[model samples]
Target chain A: MLIDTLITGLVAGGTYALVAMGLTIQFGISRIMNLAHGDTIIAACFASFVLFSVFGLSPILALMIVVPVGYVLSDAVYRIIMRPLVARAPNAGALEVDSILVTFGLLFVIQGVLLVAFGGNYTGYAFLNTPVDLFGTIVAANRLLALLLALVFGITLIFVLSRTRWGMTLRAVSIAPENAPLVGIDINRAARTAFALGGALAATAGVVVSMYQTFTATIGVIFTMKALIVVILGGKGSLTGALIGGLLLGLVETFVAAYIDPGLTLAATYAIFLLLLILRPTGFFGQAG
Target chain B: MNTTVAFILAAAALAGLAIAPLFLNAYGIGLLVGMTGYVVLASAWAMFSGPTRYVSLATVAFFGIGAYTVAVLSETLPYPLVLLCACAIGLTVALIVGLSTLRLAGIYFVIFTFGLAELIRQLVTWYEVNVTGTLGRYIFLPFEGIHIYWQLLALAAATLLLSWWINRSRLGLALRAVGDDEVVAAHAGINVSRAKLMLFALSATIITLVGAIQAPRWVYVEPAIVFNPTISFLTLIMALLGGATRLWGPALGAIPLFLLFEWLSANFPNYFSIILGVFFIGIVFFLPQGVLAKIEGLRRPARKAPPENKERSGAA
Candidate 1:
């Protein structure tokens, strides 16, 4: 039971980390905490669902189409709306809050549009009907595959952030944009790229989530909140932080539920989040300000 | 005399509310009461968002607290005392929370408050599950229907007065400074942290008072309903719709928008949320200054060029 639970927790945490990675990069590079991130995820989820229910395509194949569309949509949003704001010279907090407003406005639109397009019904995939026995306990094959996909994406994200020149430039901009421009970095373009990358991650998470559980249009708000918690817990700007935080949260929530009541799972998760904020405001692996 | 005028105005509003039930149908009365609660909640929402510029999604927390306080308190005490207790409970919790997080700035504050709200929701849900036998609690009040209108009206009036006082007070000035520039506000001799903490507590108190009234009015209290983000969303819409940094913006925004919502919901039914959501987004992006400012501009379109002295003073 413990092994099964631990594996399940890890898988869940891995998926969360995948979602948090997008948030981490956007916040770190652009200093924009995009609240509409989850709405886009919800949009992607519905997109996958529509592809599945209408065209009878497999979830994996649907993801390929949804991911690119998500990236393009987010890139367009950044170019059309957020780019103008980021181009301006203003207080960091003001700019960040504007991002929140812009993203929140987008959230409202996406949610409304989705509800209009598809009734508020839960959508899910039924690919893995049989559970595979791992050692002594039974686990779903899809869960394992989802975790593998998440791990692959997470590793790729880390590689991009750490190894690429563009990634280094993003870090430079995040650390000091004033200096980045002096060093010949196009801060606007970098920020826009980060936004697109984050959008792709959101869509990827959405598609994976649709594969795992049933979801509806209203899930956007809750998902956004959950992702925010993960972002904060993971150390606002650190992908490593997001991974650790997500895993910790997943394990903690699962253990808490296992020991206590399942109904209070959210409460326990929130409590730990509060504790983390009070104790280490910057987060576990976060660099010091 | 000023106090008397304020009192008379409040009384007149209450009187109008009392008669609203006689003319309107039950559904209309229900909608009015819900909107009143929302206005109160939204104004309380402004106490933090307006001055701090931190759009907290935690209005639901104190709202649930207020709702549950009423549910739990009305079992033992009178409705008025329960209402008072609810506000006190809300105030105390807000104070503790504010003190803990007031030192954090910008997004940190937002996260802290948001986390705290989610925590409260969890506790409420846990309580409902273990103790209350469900995920929600229902409040039963002796007097039903329009009889509660006076109470709601009184609550709204008190909220209006509180907002007015806050706007005119030194604390309000300090909060505004904090919102605009914390470093400058601190350097300029305002105890920025204390000011934020006070405002947080004050905002929670106002929201809780509204929750107290709402609990009895709805005759039901649930984790979902009380912790509903609708309170925060509507408050945000209202504050933004009326311009945040003003006294009467929330009321101006909430009252009319809610009326509009009533109209839409009555007519469209199914597509109500979709339409409302779209409209909200459109307004936010296009008119960050809010609909009220646009209306005000149109109504008074600088009829005559202001005197040079008046213009200078206004600029100053």
Candidate 2:
């Protein structure tokens, strides 16, 4: 029983970790806090739903197409919108509230567009119901696969961030963008790459998530809040922290629903976040300023 | 006090509103009420943002608190008493939250406020599910001669007057000082903390009153509408569009946009949100200072002295 629960918890945690990693990467590398990241995920989910539900394609193949499309859309947003913003305020320590607002506005625009196009209906795939029997328990194959992928992605992300030359340049740009330009690193190029990678991660998670639970356009708000809580709880710019926080949160929420009233789960999760903020604002692995 | 001018204008506006039911359709009246609520909420939001330069994204939290307070209390208490309860709750929450988070500067404050609002919203949803069983409380219309329309009008008037009074008060000067330069304000021996707390409380009170009026109009108060993220963003847009620093700016900004929203949502329905979001984003990127600033510049092109020059003259 415990193993089943742990496996279920880890799989759930993995999907959250994927979303959290997307958020943490942008936050760690560019400090943009891409509030619209989850919206992109929701949009991609709808796009994938169309491919599977309407066109009769396999969900896995649909994801292969949607992930790249998501990356391209995000890259366009970064170049046309965010790049100009950075150029306008080249010496700033952080992006302005206006930048946040613009991204947030984009979130609404994307959600509204999806809502109009698809109507508000929960979409899910049937083939994803393939389950793997472990002892007496049955776990969905996709959930297990997603969990394994998340672990592999998490370790790979940490390795890339900590080891690579591009990673070193990203850290420098984050620490000091103006000085980074002086050192011959192209700030715009780095930001675009970070946003594209972030977008792909979000879309991948979205595809996996839809396989587990049905989704609608309105799902974006709740998903965005969850991803944000995981990112914040894990600590800013810490990939390992994202995984740990996501796992802890997934367990807590799953247990909270199982034991206590399901209605209290959101409040409980939020309370934990508030406690974390009061106790350790920097998060578990985040450096103290 | 210019009581005569105030009374005459009040009487004219009230007379127009009272007769609105006679001339306009239910849709128009509904849209008007919504616009009025946004006006009060938006202007109250501006009171603090203009003076303190904080651009408080947490105004919705207080607004939600006030709304829920009214919704819960209206079940037991009179409507007027519900307003008082909401005001008190709003002020208390704002004071505690402001003191704890106000010290953070710039983007951190915005993030904190955003988190705070979301927390409160989640709490509200939990409370609604557990205590009220999802549907939540509804306000009954006009038990006596008093109607929702009149009550909403009164709240709007009170909000406008409060905003106007603050604009002329010493706290307003302190708030403006804090916005211009917090370090300088502290160096000048201004009670920066006290000034901000006061503005926070005042803004909460006004927005709470707006929420109080809003509860009865919908005849139902649910967590979703009370603590909606879009409503918070809309209020910010209204305040920015009109002019955050100026009195009546939010009203000027919100009234027209609210109408536009009503028109678009009614006609296009699905595409309205995309259009609104794009428009808001374009405005923010291109006009960071807002449309009101451009209008001010256009209205008094020659009268526009540089901010530094004005400061130097004022200092001398």
Return the interface RMSD of model 2: 6.8
What is the per-residue lDDT of model 2 for residues A1-289, given as tens digits with 9 covering 90 to 100? 6667777777878888888888887776766767687888787777777787789887679778988887897788888888766665433332544466677778888888988888888777766578799777888887777777778877887788779998888878767776898989997788888888888888888877776777888677666667777877887778888989888888777777667766767777777876765677777887764
DockQ of each: 0.35, 0.31
User: Which candidate has the highest DockQ of all?
Assistant: 1
Name the top lDDT candidate: 1
lDDT of 1 by residue, A1-289 (tens): 7988898888888878888888888888877778888888888888887798889987799888999998898899888878765655255776676677667767767887888788788767686656988888888887877788888888888888889987899889878877999988998888888889899999998888777778898878767777788888878788888877877777877877787788777877777776876788777877766
Residue lDDT tens for model 1, B1-316: 4978977987787687768778988887788787887777777787777877876667878887888888777878987788888888898888867766677656776766655666787787777678867655567788665766667777778877887788789998888788767788889999988888888888888887777766776676666677776566667777778776666787778888888877887898777666766677676556565666566666886675332112111000
Off by over 4 Å in 2: A1-4, A54-57, A90-94, B1-28, B53-55, B58-60, B105-109, B112-125, B128-134, B141-146, B168-170, B177-195, B299-316
Alpha-carbon DockQ of candidate 2: 0.31
The TM-score of candidate 1's chain A against the true chain A comes to 0.96
Q: How does each model score on TM-score?
A: 0.91, 0.88
Backbone clash count for every predicted candidate, in the order shown: 1, 0
